[model samples]
Target: MSAYRGVRIADFTQGVAGPMACMLLGDFEAEIVKVEPPGGDRLKDHPGYSAWNRNKTVVTLDLSVPADLAQAKDLARAADIAVFDHPPGDLEALGLDAASLRDGAPHLIHVWMPPYGTCGRWSRMPPRHSLLAAISGIAFRQGAHGDSPIHLILPIGWYGQAVMAAGAMGAALYERGASGQGQAVTVSGLHGVSEVGGVVMVLDQPRLPRGAPQGASPSYRLYQCGDGEWFFLATLFMPFFRKAIDALGLGAHWEVLVLNPALALDVLEEVFRSQPRRHWLGLLADAGVPCAPVGNRTDWFAGDAVRHAGLRLEFDDPVRGPLAMPGPPARLSATPASVRSLPTAGPLPAWGPPQPRTIGPGASRPLEGVRVLDMGSVIAGALAGAVLANLGAEVIKIESPEGDPFRSDGGPFLTCNRGKRGLGIDLKQPGAKEMFFDLVRQSDVVLDNYRFGVRKRLGVDYEALRQINPRIISCSVNAYGDAGPRAPLPGFDPLLQAEGGMMAAQGGDAEPVLHTIAVNDVATAGVVAFGIISALNARRRTGEGQEVITSLLAQSLTFQLGEVVTWEGRPPAPSGGIDCVGLSPAHRYYECQDGWLAVAAETVAEAEALLTVLGTQADPTDALTAPPEGPLAGRLAATLAGRPRAAALDALEAAGVPCAPCVRGYEAYDDPWLAENDVFVAWRHPRLGEAVGVRSYADFDRTPGGFRHPVPDAGEHTRQVLAEFGLAPERIEALLAAGAVFEPAAARSHLRDGGAALFTQ
Candidate 1:
């Protein structure tokens, strides 16, 4: 059964993010009708377009012509969904905006991707992914003071935003299937960047530790062994730290290890350098520390984990020949995601007919009948369950008696937890155990992001839960994998960034930089949500639920693959920081009269052509710093320095050079591009009046769903949620009196309780 078979998407997206969302839909057997301009999208000739546009038919449509405009509208009217990334009003000028189609094809799903959305302070300014990265503070976290913010080796902000869009679309489609209406979905690159790295901004954590650089404590960072091979230690918590100490025979220095990271690093460094990475990794693993080799892309591919997990994929394209890339970062037994070569594989990967669904009565969302017990904390796991909630799952958030620390953290919490129900309980109270087990018995799944073994410690591990309800799907999220050297240790998002080589890639060897965006955690949230959906799909067939485990370490590796390709026998590589250290002149940033801009030209001829547009002639005999660096680079740089950004952009684009102006739009509130895309909205924040917000990244043809309401105050739903779980009012009152369960705020007085209330709201 294909996950998205029979779905038809009319895509008018350009560049990486929007195209990638529709591409994933294609991977799942959705029909993609990609409408390109005369010259094609900005990346039509680029390899990425191929990577993302598989299983699709392409058509050229010049919207300026009345005939082509009619044809494009016809395609949109016929599609179950239409996706575009153009800024505000671009489609409206051509009479193809939301209002135009709403009457003719009310069932059409209209989705728009923008840099900044339409109504926010920054809505009108156009920004590329790099600028979003900088505004999100991810760059600031990537380097130390006096260092200019380093851009990531990959378009992480865009990709992360796209992944979120894919999930949003999937949910929308599912909703449409249940209902019979369609509506708009909007996702913004800047907000996506903000969500991924939001842990720092939301938690009030500094970019780095007070005075120290961004590296972790002694046993949880990169260490080079005698062979110069490097491996990472991810023991962020004390238990894992103890294991590292015991494994390294440094138990005698427990007191200093307890308080002094500097002293401990010195001691551990000497011991680590004395042995090879393999030996230390083995010993650390045996000692129960979570550790993995500091490998590049090649090493990662060669590792046993990816192949076993089906993370790597290969497709033989007739036009492009053999093309290999990482497969979907998830796996499902019954309905797995597939990849294919364009014009080669027939319909990409063919799929079995979808199994008939068992929809609940009066349902208007994809996950209408599903129930989830979200015991998630902080960012990753909570967000994962929140995805389910927004999809119409009955999610009851189980917070501690003290409340989710996040309820006080502000927007990150409110936005992430907007649609879910909340209940506060202290499992430590003996009386609460049965109540939790009761909730578990009714739930289809249980999710958490506790430290590696906290579920077991709390007697809520999969095995124990299975004893109560055999079909319960158990999912656990952590900083590191479950069975490694640092498994028992605790970790934070940026700490994982530092250990997993992202910071190193951005900041180089000086001091470990951190990407505050929690890129790993954000991507991992999507992965977790996908994994849960996959598990649910599998369980439907097997009638047996299984445990799903994921880690920040694994996700960060997937994100870092663009910068580092590792192989067996490869020596360790240092991060080449953001100053064009490893990129070609064409791929590097250049100064312009107004600001900065970036370009990419893989071949010397391409570079030469670009230089010509910049008014410089290429000199074959000139010395070059990067390979194939034509003589015109230095001269082109000097010329670009004097030209205003718009003029330079016009020339380069006319010459077909791959480039974009790096404008700072984080503070701007007016850009026609964003307004046309419908990415921004003036959301009403109860306390802040009308505040700008980004919408979810999906549109549905049937049921256009959104957050039921703004984030609830912690314990606001305690009484109501308990009543739904079959508890009598007296029982709820008794539990409240006993202090086993908590409800700090009054339940909304007027609304009928349960997920169904969202329709009325």
Candidate 2:
């Protein structure tokens, strides 16, 4: 929405994460002045630069020059938010750090995003996504089981960082509206790992359920048809999987299929291969199974589905000419976000700070007084609520009487549902709708991931809820956008991954490879969170709330923002081959004698240093100008093949090239670098006992948040919450007796066993 209307920002950042973060705000009508250096951003030529710098005013200044530095400081002091990404201590010398600028403009929201953090063991490392991914176990997570790590072509973590920063900015603004003061916000590239990897990257015993590198499970993986075309079957939930079996005439094999997934894998593979893609897809679609044909980004760009859903944007650029790329991440029904204009070079516009907002007293957290009802199940919808919970909203996750099937999915459930209380009710029962509307009357937001019309049928759609609470916000997540032909189809992460070209891109020239990171699911959570908060910000100003919407389909394009664009004279979008080493020899993973080493040498100087370390005769400046399918890549690989991993990293680091060992996500728990930064959070769960996950990604100087509650058991807080909401004890008991409300036997056992220790660390 135009929730950020009238907001002004001084964007003193470059590269993927920082620029994308600022651009997301600009999408909603925020006025941004991008202050570039005399030579412009180091990534100015990168494909995504055009998309990331849209809807902003661009100006160039040399911070080393006194006159230019003063102009930059003036712009920062005059803005509502000042955002920058620099190595630790680099900005203080220029008098642009938070303390320096905030001294003169106490109302400016200062944000700094270092590669690691403002202060940490790896803070000074070059802000390279490859190095961050390697050191933080992202590379290892992308690798196939029993395979060497594959360097990622998609900078998913950086995108995660961008969305997290955008949300944190909204949180800060919401808080400032109350206190009439601004504060410093920090969201590091490393913090992005927490946003995307929180589910699988754990430091606990009994690791989360994992799938083969190809897919999550037999029913939820990619398959090749007889015509050689591939499609992803995404029946992650059992009901759909069972439907798929019955539709396939395999009902007789259902017992074995349910009990022995390994055997079922073989049967399903043969069954899918027996027919052409269209034939199987037709049957599956008729049976209401979720699946999509594997496609590439180039084709996806031309798809009718995207155009129909309005997820594609067309803009004319002075340099790139006519360009087409992805639209904003979320859709706001009332105050919709739009692409106003492309960034153009200009001097800073004359500006002054506006009158400060004077609202009611602020709380300890940005969303402290906000209340939310999370009716979403599984990852995308549930994780959105968890994000709001971390932002200090009181979130209650509503489940059916039998509870969310995903609750048994272990770490994934804990990851998405943490910091929220649980309530269980059967809406079909006599008094359930009355009880639900009571909670809706008091809540500010309601979230769900049901298919397009399911909410309307369930009597919880936006129209139904708005009638009950005029100020209520409704957030809906789905596989596709709200009004597309596919909007009514059931879908999941891999379905979008297949249709949006992620699988083809990641797989390169080989068969489609499904990323195990749950890229679409994780990213949708953050985006949905931002949309909900953006609506909240709008409500604060206009005294009304509206619909907030996002889908995995939108995020699929967003995750590959750089590659999802096309324009005249634009270079080919970079795609890694099956090797997954990298886009070029200078910036990729190299196998060493002991382990893998990742090197990031994109610039001429860094490329020269890398060549020198490898004793290569290749011209440094032109080394990466061509694809790495030449002798240069071969030589670089040959040189590192003889050396040990640690030695290669040492040589590269000493030569001023960024590098890190490809450490497994699980092994990162023992790394002293991350430990020194205190990046992990440990909490207890009623069912799973002690567990550790990545901490909250964004940091607010005046209002920090961390683990405040454990994962809730089904209906765990139903009685307490109902009583607190003014329901009498007898009424609650009567509802429970009438089967309108429920607490499972396991939850009752937990209470009897003194589960007070569940929320403790």
Candidate 3:
């Protein structure tokens, strides 16, 4: 049985974020009642809309009218959750706000996706996905390098918001099973966008630097081959660098190039260009170095690997003919996720009580009875642990005696390792293997994000651990997936961005830019968490355990789902998005007197309305479907430039045209909306006192998630963890004396305040 089989959602969201979140719930077998506006939800046939809106029953309602408003309120009263992207007062004006809903339906989870969250000053200001990206400083770091800003042609910010919302909703659903209550949940485009870039997005009072125009190191950047095709390298650290040099067969220039990265690019470029892309790929693959061929949308969408991996879904719709959408990113062994017919209404699969199993006792969180042993490193692995912790799993993070290599990475580490007890033990030590196995025996699951072969080489692979505890589920994450030709090669987030065509699709004919944010890593982390949940659910159906796997490749595909495709004879259709200068003047960025802003007219009616606002006689179709740069684009830009951002926004919004100003940099947190829900809060840290941190983007009725303790110092819980695991005090002391494990100077003060049991139902 799916986790949310009997749950029902009242979906009033029209655009990307809310619909996407509800769609994910639908995948988990939740029933969705999607209430669109009278004309139907916008972007109806658009790939993103169509794909996400699957498994939903759509109905139209005009909340502005008394009758329709009453109808929406009725749905809200009956639903387990209500989702909407309406501004702060829209529902209240219609007498259906959270406060009103609480009065009538306190058990309903009211999810609101405000632009900046319910912060102070800018809560009411509108936002488009590009505007969110711009405010995140992504566009500036993505290409313009701070002098000017450019928008990413994709709706990443909006998509990320949806993922965060879905995660929160899942946790809330679990909590509701115990509490029989629901609370208001909030996710802002601004908060979601910042989190997608957590590696660079600081959680302290001050922020980190955004981007370097030229990459910090040539070895880690793009290199073009003889065919003028760029292939990314896997040279993030010393081991990877050694492997890369061995594969390239480079000699004397290694030292000079490694020390002097400014001079490395020209030398490496000339070296790479000596061979065709395929030759280098072959060499890298053979030597266990990560590299991939750069291609256009056609090249990526038509790849054999994607089809084999079930990342592609094809269905013959009666009205829309053949339809293909990116399939669900995670795969489960027992009760798999399926794409159901939109019109079908039937009883969900029969789900009985789960088979009993042993697990550690937990505090008042959703996964209270679950115990997880986290042997993960870096962004993807560490983040998966954090997500699990949010659900009330007792996560014991096992690191080396020297600590996780990424502990000093600052912001990323702080963001991904918060809700866990830390134990530092050297896996290379004599008794380390037995100690790890003992923990595994007690754990319900063990998770890691090491390279493809590391676990096997260390004798801690699934096959080895399952021998000790037959009911243990092991989840592993890697660069390329499990069993591929390129599986052995290591992967980094930026490298995947380059290999996945994000740069090419982003830059077009211009110089390709690397997104400074670690989007793929963070996104993949969420998918991993989802996989763990699915596996746990599967265990309920069958008294067994299994290995679950996900990869960066899967997330990259999911991220660019709607925009990427292969069309016959179109030569992959340039690089970026729909040709906005010619075909979508109203859907691209435009400059006002003071700054740039994003606007979109996805439908003909909206285009016509925008044309009316511009007072242009030119047919809207000409601008919307032109083959070359349209005159209407210039006209719109000119008209927009004459007005200030506020006036232009006000005018466009009055006409019902979607638009927002391009906001960026530290100004990101200035919006007042976040204060309303504590979306971005400052939790006290013992070391970094009063450091900034974000609460889970979700707010629950019961068992709401927050920092149980400050981020732990190395080995913060070593003694406590050993004692809890039934290890003798003398044995622990001996190990500590032998330097096999690390013991901190003192127990964390934060942990002294009840630690993992901070939130109770």
Best candidate according to TM-score: 2
In candidate 2 the C-alpha lDDT for residue 232 amounts to 89
Q: How do the residues 730-753 of candidate 1 rate in per-residue lDDT, one tens digit apiece? A: 988888887778875532222211
Compose the digit string of candidate 3's lDDT tens values, residues 1-761: 76567678888887777887788778778888788776776666555666778788877777788887877787787788888787767767777777787675656777887765554444554555655655454455443444445556567777777777877776655455455666777776754664564322334434544554224456566677898777777566556666777667775567876777667777778889899988988888778675666565545555766665667676666655666666777665445676785433233223232222233322365566678889887778888888778667788888775466566425557777878888878777778788778888888889998888999999988899889988788988888777656566678776667766777776677556555556677788777776786666556556577787778877877677656532222224334422222126766677788877667666677678778877777776765564323566888778878888878777777887766656554444453433454545656656766655566645554455655766777787898998898989998887777666776653221221111010100
lDDT of 2 by residue, 177-278 (tens): 888888899888877777877552234445433335567578888899999999988887677989899999999989988899889989999998899999
Residue 297 displacement in candidate 3 (angstroms): 3.2
Best by lDDT: 2
Q: Which is superior by TM-score, 1 or 3?
A: 3
Task: Score residue 408 of candidate 2 by CA lDDT.
Answer: 54
Which candidate order results from sorting by lDDT in descending order?
Answer: 2, 3, 1
Residues forming the 10-long window of minimal summed lDDT in candidate 1: 752-761
In model 1, what lDDT does residue 40 have?
Answer: 74
In candidate 3, how many Å is residue 289 off? 2.1
**Model 1, residue 550: what's the lDDT?**
76
Clashing pairs in 2: none
Write out the backbone clash pairs for model 3: 118-673, 119-672, 119-673, 119-674, 120-672, 120-673, 121-672, 135-663
Which TM-score value belongs to model 2? 0.94
